[model samples]
Target: MNVRVMNAAVAKTVAPDKPAAAAPAHIAATGLAVDFPLEGRKQRVLNDINIAVPKGSFVSLIGPSGCGKSTLLKVMAGLVTPSEGTMTVAGLSPQEAVNARLIGLVFQEATLLPWKNAIENAAFLLMTADETIKKSEAFDRAAAMLKLVGLDGAEKKSPSQLSGGMRQRVAIARALALDPEVLLMDEPFGALDAITREEMSECLLDIWERTNKTIVLVTHSIDEAVFLSREVHVMGTGPARIIETLPITVPHPRTEESYSDPAFTAAENRLRSLLIESHKKGRR
Candidate 1:
């Protein structure tokens, strides 16, 4: 379907609720930097990065390649330690939040276990991370999560039996099973076809609405960034740092109609301009 048709069809879907009070910041980074040692020299990846994401809000980090968007995400996921400065999730260090199952990460690839069935894959994290969760309970929770992601009848199927979207759904279910307070996704849908990508976007918004998890996404698509995020942070490369943080006021449960809205266009244009300027500076 065309964008307009899709918008009209999905227009009746209920929009997400707005937060009644000011929620506390769930993710905070101050002067964060990352560097790697290469050939007896330090290669800087990020520099003086700072951001604050309020609880239950959805945010996106967007910029050109090599801008450290993914690096910042890994820092928040406890997968990489910052070379300098400090960052926190829910007032706790990233490692602490990760250990408590307060942070969940989804990468570009689904990365499902080939041997495991759908439900098994979804329960993998719960079974391995939390010793207190019994096998049966884990399976039950996984099943519920899979259902939540629109895989109600595919529980017995293996990864090979599923489509690309279904496998990603399993991945998402697995992350949600952790009941994380914050979700960090790095280009999770970058590999999908255009139609499937759109479908997954809708799926994500529904999940976010129901769970109210604080999310920070990294993506190159301006439309995806504007459609899903309440705030879009634009970054620049040369030792990477944020250049602008634009609030998206396009309203909740955005449909195809949203892409044409003035607010969406404005956000997309602003981000594009910032990225172009960043690229120009990098070439200098």
Candidate 2:
């Protein structure tokens, strides 16, 4: 659907006089800034930021550890309110979308209940998000989501019984069970080993392609960003702001060989240089 229709569906708080062409972006921020009060001084974290994520797009925010990448993701998820500026998810306020159950979130840690098995953990989210779903139906839905994330045979396993990658898969399955229109992830695979990280990236790409959900991922891995995202929103440090939105032109259905392609290499190199510069600026 076009931006106009999307905006209408979400119903923005923007001025009615604003033309439809100037409607709120699928996910956007206008002069967005954020600060935290520390020691009687406002410590800014995000500065004069502006962004627009189109519908059904896969986007990544990449930067150094202190560069506010996670903060930006939090703002989008409505977990942390921005100190200034207006932001929207699908035209509605972040909290509005969140309350509407139109957005799902995944984080670095799986954050599963140790006592609950995989199916229970996944089904719990479905029931929590929508109380109308019956217990049996919730389990059925969760089972399907577990299968989608490639955790088919491990449905009855508790958190301790699963591998790190499998735990993350369960987290992803829980998020997907909500059937959200958008998924916001913050370093969801950051804790995994290198081999598992790469594997998860491929698995996530397959899911994104199949679900067509608007996704915003915050990660420190340039290779992961280039491989999985249609565009990478690189951020600068010291009250972080977006430095560039680099488009990844490499073909989709990306495989292990895709990493060696010149396009992917070039994109990775470009992001690396930009991040290096951002780090240097932070040190200055």
Taking all chains together, each candidate's TM-score versus the true structure is: 0.91, 0.90
In the range 46-153, model 1's lDDT, one tens digit per residue, is: 998878889999999998898989999999999999999999999999999989899888888999999999999999998888988999999999999999999999
Question: C-alpha displacement of 101 in model 2, angstroms?
Answer: 0.5
Candidate 2 residue lDDT tens string, 179-202: 998999999999999999999999
Give the Cα lDDT of each candidate: 0.86, 0.86
TM-score of 2: 0.90
Off by over 4 Å in 2: 1-24
In angstroms, how far off is 13's CA in candidate 1?
30
